[model samples]
Target: MSAQLPKIFITGATGLVGSALVTELLAKGHHLRALVRTSSAQLPGSVEQVVGELGQPVDLSDSQVVIHAAARVHVMQETTSDPLVEFRAVNVDATLALARQAIAAGVRRFVYISSIKVNGEGTEQGKPFKTNDVPAPADPYGISKMEAEQGLMALAKESDMEVVIIRPVLVYGPGVKANFRSMMNWLNKGIPLPLGRIDNKRSLVALDNLVDLIVTCAQHPAAANQTFLVSDGEDLSTTELLTRMSKALDRPARLLPVPAGLLELSGKLLGKDAVMQRLCGSLQVDISHTRDTLGWVPPVSVDSALRKTADHFLSTL
Candidate 1:
């Protein structure tokens, strides 16, 4: 360990990624300052909390690195009015505002947690997305993230700070919600799901793996001014994922051969085509650049991570 650990400031410390990152950084002996809204709860022992909204200016004094992980992540309904405005307030405006503060405070590194949607929705013919590909953000959330990255890169060019952007795909683990929890619920009930026939590769990152990469980027010299796409490096089809979940839970896999198109249509009628798209869409990420450049590999394998997820779910039952 370095004699003097870097003073790190993080946003979204209560969020899935931010909380995990806080744990990882604490283990590495880094000094942390976390920003939180007035309504946010205090984190575990001794973390310095500076109460402020994401839209407000951050005080980055004594901070050497800033990890901007806060964002509005929910996919809004099609009828959502001014979705972009809401997303921009946190994702773009606040992110840049914090970055500017970090630069002024003499922070050397800024790590931004972006999303894979910046690359695009789905891959071409099962081919994974690379880091250098042009950004094709589909939704307001994705567009906001993309614009934030551009703004951060421009800020880096003008300031002394080194900016490293990471795009993580489908992160899941303990305390996960929405689709991940729903999947676990289906498995727990031993329900026969009609997802056995759909063969689509979905790339995912374990919470630990994503945190490890972020910590590495925070310190690694090669990570400066680079954009990287990260994942577990093992793509799994929906059936394969369900099968593994079953094995992890020590339950029999119950799968039916329902037509993929029919399922998609049903989801559409229910205004849940996005959910179906996530389960059945092919969204692979090529992380060779991160590995080759930073010599970083995901510390946990897909099987082990999946098993951990299952174990967590089982323990909760």
Candidate 2:
């Protein structure tokens, strides 16, 4: 990177990944221009926030690189009555619109943060997902992401802007919500989870590790016109993960040797089979290409990351 850092524009500056990204970019001495909604709060001092919506025309005239990280994530269900129409508004239409504006503004690079769901819900037995695998998005969210990727690729071919797409699995760290919070809750309550007997491997990325990878992609020449699946480069089963969390929390992990089949059957009966599968099923990613290409490795180990997350949780309590 040059001493005079490039002017970078980021969307969804307040989001989970986006917020961390903003901090990382600032630390690297990059000038930041963040696109935010009217209702959004002020960002960090380093970022210049531009109030705008996805549907509105974006002004990227001064930006050297654009990172599209904004989306209507978890707003609507994929099985909704008209998911395509709903998702296309932000995920496809708005994203493509922004890309077009970026190109016209002479932005040299565009990095898109996508999801591993684009590869499908589950992985093959004992095999992690790779970048070369064919896309088989199972839900509307995944389908929309795939469409956005394709659109960006086509635009890249037509314009001078370089495009890089990243598909990251289960990212966790401080300020996390939903599943991460639930896991913490379980550990706090000392509940003996039924996952003790399961040994299904799942891939996860820590926020710091993921942010490092994203920043590296933004500047690395090798990242242009490439797609990568990112993780912590370590796979862990639910039981193992819980154990680590327990260790981090300095608490005994209360776990039962329950059978996976029984747990699945109970979850199905309770109308939570999908949730159960996600918790117990194996979903791994192969990041060898990322290492060999960009010469990037995860900065934080899983143990340290988990401990930090646990410490954060403990602090709040």
Candidate 3:
């Protein structure tokens, strides 16, 4: 007999990840209940909409799987005086609340979308982050996710609901925001960058690949009670990424091979060390566990995904 399509409840349905997730699942004939803040967002007619934030109660009693993609993502120069407190309200406290409710609703699986930052800031060239590594969250965002993971684990121990955590590295695709979009804009606009000399390996995941894994986990028996890290499984240096982006944009990559040390110093003096560190550092993930355990591979190649991202970027402008 063929496998049955599960009824999935999703949060953050308007954001990039959630939106794409909705589309992917529906394309495979799964029933989706998307929780959004507005009804005006463009979505297929078949998708059931629960218009509200995570605070309000939506019926998940019949949902086979609950995919929590909503969170307090990292914001640059947040104006809130108590950013941590504000972040906790969403990432930590709100997450646990929803998880507890899902458990009460008898949801079969709760897949929490976590960040790779829970592992650490970055990795050395040869030392990629593994799923078993002790969490060393550096920023407020990472710390909150780590706390949420702990809370969910404790809750899972007391309930029949299976909790699966997936910590994905930087996710990029059409309509990407923040840092990835910034890089796309810079390269698309023909801005000369100083990251040519940096020798680093960073792991990034395409949206399609991440969504594929999430769907696999939604039904895979082995994925239950497992915490895994996911990526494109292809690491690229800053220069290489820029070159690829330029190729996608059909533009010349005018790279200045300035010393990485000098660039970092300038960033520090200008209060942008975090930005420089991301460009000049290595952050790789070891996805062997996920691949071996699930018998899965990234569905999209890096080149094709990047090209699609660039095309979408150009269309947006």
Best model number under lDDT? 3
The segments of candidate 3 whose C-alpha lies over 4 angstroms from its true place after superposition are 1-3
Instruction: Give the count of colliding residue pairs in each prediction.
Output: 0, 0, 0
Tell me how far the alpha carbon of residue 200 in candidate 1 is from the true structure, in angstroms, after superposition.
1.1
Model 1 alpha-carbon drift over 4 Å, by segment: 39-42, 76-80, 268-271
Cα lDDT computed for each candidate against the true fold: 0.88, 0.88, 0.90
What residue pairs are clashing in model 3? Answer: none
Compose the digit string of candidate 3's lDDT tens values, residues 113-227: 9999899899999899999999999988999999999999998899999999999999999999887888888887889988788889999999999999999999999998899
Cα-based TM-score, every candidate? 0.95, 0.96, 0.96
**Best first by TM-score, ranked:** 3, 2, 1
Q: Which ten residues in a row have the lowest lDDT in candidate 1?
A: 38-47
TM-score of candidate 3 to 2 decimals: 0.96
lDDT per residue, candidate 1, 1-317, as tens digits? 65588888988899888888888888778888898886456476757888888867778888888888889885735556888998898899988888887888899999999999899899854689999998999988899999999999999999899999999999998778888888888988999999988888889999989999999999899999999999998898888999998888788889998878888899999999888897777899899999999999999998888888888888888
- Residue range 129-205, candidate 2, lDDT tens digits: 89989999987788899999999999999989999999999989987788887898898789878788887899999
Instruction: State the displacement of the C-alpha of residue 54, model 2, in Å, after optimal TM-score superposition.
Output: 1.2
Q: Tell me the lDDT of model 3 at 83.
A: 84
253 Cα displacement, candidate 3 (Å): 0.8
